[model samples]
Target: MIVTAKQASSHCGGHPAMNSAKPTLPAQILSQTPSTSSITDRLWRHSLYNVLDQQPLDRVNVLGDNSHGHLSCVNTLSWTPDGQMLLSGGDDRTIWRMDPDYDVDYPFVCKSVIQTGHKANIFNAHLLPHSTRIVSVAGDNQVRVFEAAAALAHSQSEPETTYSIDQLDCRVLRCHTNRVKRIVTEDSPDLFLTVAEDGSVRQHDLRVSHTCGPGGSCPAPLIKCQHELSALALSPLSPYQFVVAGESPYGYLFDRRNTGRSFDEEWGSLPPTSGPSIATCVRRFGRKTKPRDDVYGTHITGARMSSHNGHEVLLSYSGDAVYLYSTRDNPQDEDEHHGSSIIPSSQEHRTDVIPIASDESHIDVQLAETNDNEASSPLQRATADQGDLDGSDSDDLTLDAMPWDDPSVPIILPRRRFAGAGNVETVKDVNFLGPEDEFVTSGSDDGNFFIWHKATGELHGIYEGDGSVVNVIEGHPFLPLIAISGIDSTVKLFAPVNHRSEFSRIDKQEDIIRSNSRGSGQLMTRGQLALIRAALSGQELSEGNPCNVQ
Candidate 1:
């Protein structure tokens, strides 16, 4: 069902008559009104409307192992500050380092591995912004730090030797009671924050010994919630502020400066009663579902602050949507302070409190009329009536009770105007592309890397990735290159091509994962090699990277 450009042109043969042995004109083409009822045809047209005219990703290199990289899911991917190396962790219970390989035809080679410190699946991995230290959290309820330079120095020079547990310079800390879901870092290499399945957020000081054998002391928890958390991000501007998303309906904001209690007391301090000063903001995306149904409501996959603007919060959800919410002072702030809004008995609000449909339609009109870069977002329109004020005390206002009015509603940004690849998977993460944050990109479960125009809310591009779910898409810190990883276990990089010769053709998935009476094999099978040779000798070839099976 997947048709490449070359196949379409050849099959059409300039006219429909080429396929008609009788050479008759189709009456349907000449009909006055279209009467198409085919669902497949309708779906194709719908998808075309959503697809933006943009460049597709070229195959760079695949990195993984049984013999190739990890033999399981590559759950997390991060780039070093220098952009010369990539870091990854997953179900394999090991950390991998993939560096550019200039000597080989492939763009990257994976050799360095850190296998100790974690005994279960790693959920998050990060390279400290300006340092060689790498921090990771996993299901083992531990947060571990590895010095990359130390590993490289101690590792055997033999290129084929796989670095194992005994070789890594790893420091382990037992912080959470359950699986640590994420780790967010500040500007300093020694300071970082972690959130876990046990609903506790703890701040760690790496200068102190993490091991409890002698002088080691456990760090205190920073913020603890009533439910397990799923995602976490620190504010780009404020060192003491951060956001945490969990199974609860709301994503809570926490300020470490306000907490003055010990671990046991702090963990029991519920907000509005004892910890309101520490818990600054409580925001929800879209409509407010009932307390019993909040668990089933839009489960947030990732919650992040814009790197360039701390006021803007970006949240990606399981419902195939991304929302932008603001944290500045508004008229609603006054209402909460004055206690004027009615207290709903069951935390239900008008279903239309978050006006996404109308706001999106309004944005569509504005885009067509002005085409201005400063087009106001849906958040602006939905909150326009709420009088705005300087965000002077935005950080100080804390309601004593969960506000009857939905804590904060999201301004829904339109997504997937074009037909999505499929609903097989939801996007787990989204990141800003380029320095200006002009474009947004995310990995889909459907084996596609999706890009969106930040201001216009248009689906800008859909790049082909691994044949299976693409779990991660991270743009290089300071380079134009983008790294993508997913079900294939290979970390593929995409960068702008400077010349046509740089475009090396990759074979399609059918050729790579081919099944036969003799069993399946990959990478340019004899039949595929013959086809390539025939094409080089004058046969027409298919468009796009051949390795793409989606």
Candidate 2:
């Protein structure tokens, strides 16, 4: 079912609006004179309404323990359906349900903590919609569902309750062979989707028994990508469609209906088969400037479909800038136009396809050999062509001079490009912000949240979030508040407030972009980066007692 804005707003509490009630003046003023009191009350009410209409874009609160909350970095933050609490998962193999209580000095308070019984770090976690169950994925290559009703009930009765996986009713599904990277829930609480580094995308149904699968395991994957998968996003407009991105530079759109099973049919089937029923790729998204042979440092870190516009998709690329793409045509029409799978195969000669934003930009892709002797990296070469880092020189190669610039080369570019955010060393998530999803926001390796105007691609604002890298930036379901987390143990909250301490704004956009471009070429492993981060944090380490950097 297509989810409308009104339905979404209703699901969350309705968005804050102006109260029609007139403000009451002080008793002393009311007793002194009726005319003065009446004018003062109307003016106060008008002023309050104006403030509520403005955007809430200021850092207001930090949520975590005074010493340290999670022993490691927090990876993800998700808001509950009612927007009353936030669910956060981290490398410490723990999930905290926090209440943003404005009544206290420390507004963000952890009401409960769930110790996930995973063998490794927790990657992502979320409270499923229309249900009280919480689904989580971690480095253990398994999906776990926690019956959170009891835990949540305990927390409401007595705050700060701690529950172990064994203490609560839970189910674990061993489906993936490698680390699971992401999970997304559907409209129905029974169905959900997960993607892993094993290159498998699988759908799970809580109502089905797994006895039919091989060795009594979960069902087979619907899509086995050639590249390791990292991110997944379900379309709000289309129930059976979703998008997936990974180590490859491009994002692939797939339709589950192509498997010959409708949503209703899949739900009605009592026993599921063990055989794999794969979906079809409908479209591919990528930049026109990307090189044919160079896939290094081009892996997508995050992919999100805009709730305000399903035709638009936002992507964050490691060692690069954020991009916004517009799927200009219907999925069925594009599927027929492309007429073939965009998946990479072992064949030496194959057609490379990309989504065309408009009819005027249509182009066919032909295989072309890249120069192996080029010393500079793809990022450096692209930046150098614009000019020197200082923006002065001109003799560099132009887009028309590039090998992929031929008329036969298939190329599609992004609708908007947002720069000035550092994404060189970490896997960061990008998202749309504001009540209407009017702004694009992402966290940087520099520990700051960067926002840009979605329509114009102009930098809007930047706020400090964490001490190291800010990996996640999630907007409130209906309100203007935002929750951000990173290498730090705490989650920082941003909202519109009348009073805030003065902070510096970044004015060196070109410098940040250049630095990110240089760092992208010198990438480091996650383990290595973790070690450096620990050292910078002044943690004590020894040969036998090393920090759990994972």
Candidate 3:
């Protein structure tokens, strides 16, 4: 049931056309029109979900293994900070490493295998910063650290047709007791953190291990700021404070330095609880509050505190309204500052947005507007709601939260205005363009991908996502373009030959523009090469990489 029709259809000939009992497209189709019995042709209905008609597509790579097909992609991914290799784990309970730089046949080599064996696929994997070690949490209620260099060395040292899963060193970390839904690490080399389905954030300090004995234990957490939470981000700003924003009504702020540790002999059987700081933070503050309204709320899928520059911090969250939080430094007096607003303002938002009732803050919403609403492209909208952001308390725990910068600092608004570039008018998975600010990409439920520019928010390209949700999209580092992965288990590479950067002559300008903008979607596959490479060269890639890569 987790696989979409788009994925299913990739194996069959046509899309698994929706049954539409009353012309009802199955839940798998992306943006849909509410069906009425009067609708007749079943074939025409497929047009609405026709991914090929919508977005740009180029090349595809296939993945295969001895997997009994029980393993499925968990749909989450992370790249080494170096951006050289990509990592993916799935419902199959294993983590995979792919090299976009290679040809499709050898596009990726299996870098590591996590056999800590959770009941479900591994959800997320984080390659630690400044280190080759890897940390990940899976549907199995465990977070683990695997020695990357050791695995790579072992795999390289071997000469067999296949590497044994038994040879990998995966430690079943007993930190989170719930499904390890997502994991994020500090850009710093020493620490790593994880969050679970139960909504708790746990920090792991790797230093204490060096001091312990053969029969000894590692250091206990420096601090655990407890909240029913989902995702957390260590501020990219110099202050080094981290925030976890999710299902919880309020976010937690931790000064990493305040998270000092003590050794615990009973740590093995210790149940995961709100960390030691819970009592202190909650006692000083009031009971937890709910998140903002629907336009500003939803189970937040992702969030990042952007230093966009060292002078200011803007926290942009994606859910309903794409929110931007701005904060700045004050020199007059440390405490002489104040923040704008923590609540949503109706004036700055689209009137068409149905603001959730103030009291009913959290509700799983089902849409009622499929008949008349329709907009495929982003339209720029203006606003005067400047400096509206959540500020910090100038109190004790916080002032020490970031000694590098004052805790109460609020960012001053720059006159550089931002017009709201509209949205898809449909649910889509938001993805990061590369850090270089070249492009931002997202995929809709219907297997379509949209690429948007970072500054002006103008959409660069829209393409059909094969027949599966475009779960992951990455840019090729050495070349001019991109690589895409989907729920259908196919990966592809893409490029832009029509760029102005490479050409000086304006020959056939109009024809070139039209082709790149709206070319007939074609896919190139080299899966057979992949199989041969894995077979002859003994790379981690299995002969399975050569599937029907349509």
What is candidate 3's lDDT per residue for 512-546, written digit by digit as tens? 22332222111111222233334455555321210
What TM-score, over all chains together, does every model reach?
Answer: 0.61, 0.71, 0.54
lDDT of 3 at 390: 25
lDDT of all predictions: 0.50, 0.61, 0.38
Candidate 1 lDDT for residue 304 = 72
Which candidate comes out best when scored by TM-score? 2
Q: Is candidate 2 or candidate 3 better by lDDT?
A: 2
How far in Å is the alpha carbon of 86 misplaced in model 2?
0.0
Best model per lDDT: 2
lDDT of 2 at 31: 23
lDDT accuracy of residue 409 in candidate 3: 27
Instruction: List model 2 lDDT by residue over 1-550, tens digit each.
Output: 0000101110122222122221121112212222323666445434432332353345555665555357778888888755566788888888877654322221445667888788887888988888878888989897888888766554333436678877878888887889998998887888899999987788988887665324665665777764578899876677577778876566766777767644744676443333443776656666433323233225688999877667778888776678777666432232322222222222322223222223322322222344364425533443332222112221221111111111222323355667767887678888987545678888887777787888766667766778888899987654455788899877776665544322224554555555655565465434233334445556542323110010
Report the number of clashing residue pairs per model.
11, 2, 20
